[model samples]
Target: MLVIELRLMQIIGLGTALMMPIIGNLSDQYGRKALLTLPMTLSIIPLAILACNRTTNYFYAYFAFKTLTDMVCQGSINCLALAYLADNISYRQRASAFGILAGVTSAAYVCGTLAARFLSTGLAFQVATFVSLFAVVYMRIFLEESIPADQGEGITQPILKEGEEDNIIQNDDNAPTKVPPFKKIPSLGYYLKARFHFNKNQFADLMLIGGIVATISQLFIMPLLVSPIGDGRLLSIGLFASCVYAILYSIAWSAWVPYAAAAVSTVMVFAPPSLRSIASRQAGPREQGKAQGCISGILSLANVMAPLIFSPLTSLFLSEGAPFHFPGFSIICIAITLMIAFIQSLMIGRAPSTSNAENSTEV
Candidate 1:
């Protein structure tokens, strides 16, 4: 069951990485609200279908359907939502909003898990689906398009010609102006090509590298931390400890998980914002989104790879029925990854001032 769960999660992670950028770009082209709604609405169908499948073959189908739904709805919606938030919130307030948002999400997760424990999985899932459908309806009714029609055209003006606009816009006054399909469905390939070809910015590279390193580190850390607890002697220790911890956690220490999670989230929430704030102060807001995107993309990639890479390693190295933390190999890897991340951050700081100077000049 554990192995199956791990594999399923890994597949979902990989699918998410592939889909997020596609959805994000789609949101940029269409409106975030509409694109987001489409996925949310579509996601329910799969969950509903899964609720009916009873056989082993049906289980595989369920996994595939659930994974697909998650890839489309979860990945895209999150990317669009974050971008949407960034669009409205001032830099000063963004971090606080993100922190609050993270807390809310964590709370929601805990509540959902508790609810699932009490309720049947099918009923819990169905309830979630209903809530999501309601959310989509709410968004459609209330949410305004963040990208103005005029601004959308203006942003693409350099790449799209006056003649092209005329052809795209027909004679009917009320006819929906035929925006270049590319403007509506931005392709990942095209966006990357344009970004790399036209924008020869070094900051993009920095963001990409930083993001990749961070992701790799996370991938290394998770397996090491989790797998050890699942091994022979380590497994026994972990099982006993977990029971004790669970009891304690249920009691006065119920807050500990949330507190610890908060601490970790606080760091993540602050890190990029702080970096951006310093960059904006010293260098300015030139190419901020692109740089951030590169970093985010790298992190997403890391999230996708972590489970895939770690699970197999854990299975291979750790003995069945062993305590969760036998050899301590995974922990060592995590420690090393942390050290590497620290070293990389220092190196990034010390790198030549050219990028900073350019950012300041652009600002």
Candidate 2:
């Protein structure tokens, strides 16, 4: 059962890794509003299908549709939204903005998880279908495009800046050819094929290492002392907390140890968004979308590796005839990975700080 679920997760990750860059890049080329709305609209189909049927065939179909929609929706929305935020806000406010965004998402996740625990599966899916439809409708009717257009373009029209502000405009006859989307797929296919294999220990490593990427989208802590603390130091503190979390989970002797670890892990939420806020300052105005897309791509790659790594490890350790008496061996492996992340955070602290003038210009 664990293997089956892991296989499903593997497929979802593959889809995400393959499709995230395309959707994110397209959001940069086209507009955020459109790219964000389209995939969400598509998600309704799978939800509706799941709500209506519970047969084995329908279950498989739901998985297929869910994977496809997740590919389109997963990292794309967050990437584009960050790009949009970067475009509109000043550098000084970016950390707070990102923190608020992460906070809201974390709150929503908590609420949704609690709701899921109580709701029946079929009824939950039915409610989700309506919720998705509502999201699509709300986005279409209420969400406004933030991209700015030049003089002579309509106020509501999205700006399409090819290069930097005044590089060169080309005629149709002389313009450079665009690469077809198909050209990109072979590389993604190769990545998936090459990375599909993993051992139990490797799976455990992936799952532990993946916390970095997963936390980026929803990690948050209070921003009261951020200015005084600096992003680098704050990130290092969070990473240390995460290391503690990994250690606690690894040595957990009882079920309540997991819950206690969860309580402590809340401190780890500060790391990713601080990293993002710092990185956002490093990128130029025109390249925010591309940069965020690359980050999302890395996150997708992490997602791809996680299921392949963790599932087998989990199954092995939980089985009756395990190598040693340690039931939490997989988690100890994850702790080692977390220590690596903690070291990376310390390195981030060693890097030189950017000047205020440079930061002001970048925004």
Candidate 3:
């Protein structure tokens, strides 16, 4: 299951890396709302399939369509949504708004998970499909387009004018997806169950607690830190905090220690929004979608490399015939990745930023 999951992650990563930049640039040229509608609509078909029936034939059908839709929808909507916000909000207020957006996302995740626990799997999919449909309708009716589809500068701008598209596509073209691993690898839960004796109920409890922390930090504390500290520095801080969180969990001698690491997430959770905010500051209002898409593309490509490198390492280290007895070895390796990211983030502070969005101290 774990190997299969990792392979799936690699595939999704590769597909998204190729697709995200195109989607992003198209959103810039067309409109965020219209582009967003595609993935949101594609996502519904698979869910609606599952909701209707779960027989073997239907399950296979669901699996095929789910794979197809997930590749398109993963990370794509969020990129467009952030770009849409960047278009409307003042750069000064953008970080705080991004934090709010992330908070709401975490909140939804928490709420949905909790809700699903009480409902049957069939009901959960039905509800999810319904909510997705409602969200699409709500977005179309209520949300104003920042850059109208018809009024975009032109499709040629990002290609012919900047010449940055090659760099965007060529470099960072292999990072991969983070979200699908759980669904793909049920063994992850089984592994935790073996190591920590983590039962379903206990896992749910941890999620509830972690969700509360994530929601509060993203909504309140993160917004506070961004305006005063700047996203660059905040990103560094968050990355460093994330290292501690990962290290703490990797070497956790007791079950409680993992929960303690979740507490550190109060600060660690700030990294992603901070990174996105910094990226947002770098580009002009007109180029928001392109910039965001490039970043997302890079991240998706990174996902591809992640599984290829880590899956075997994890499988070997976790197996009984391992060279070393450290169950936490793979996790420590992940911490090293965070540390590398941390080092890169520090350079952001050293470099001079031209945008007041990154340098401004006013709250």
lDDT of candidates 1 onward, in order:
0.41, 0.57, 0.71
Instruction: Give a tens-digit lDDT track for model 2, residues 1-363.
Output: 645655665676677777766776676667778778877788788889989998899988988888778767775766777777767776556666766566555544444544455789888888888888998889889988755322211111011222322221121110000011000111221222223434544433332323322333333344564555555555667677776766665565654454355554456666666666666656556556666777777766776575467546655665678787665566567667767877886664334434432223221
In Å, residue 248's CA in model 1 sits off its true spot by 18
Candidate 2 global lDDT = 0.57
- Please give the range of 10 consecutive residues that has the lowest summed lDDT in model 3: 173-182
List, residue by residue over 81-130, the lDDT tens digit for candidate 1.
Answer: 55565555444344344333333443454455455657887787788777
As a TM-score, model 3 comes out at 0.84
Global local distance difference test of model 3: 0.71
Model 1, residue 348: C-alpha shift (Å): 4.6
Ranking 1 against 3 by lDDT, winner:
3
- Candidate 3 regions exceeding 4 Å error are 148-191, 352-363
* lDDT order of candidates, top first: 3, 2, 1
Cα lDDT tens digits for candidate 3, 179-233: 1111112233444565788998887876777777778888888776664566666
Ranking by TM-score: 3, 2, 1
Model 1: worst 10 consecutive residues (lDDT sum): 174-183
Clash tally for model 2 = 2
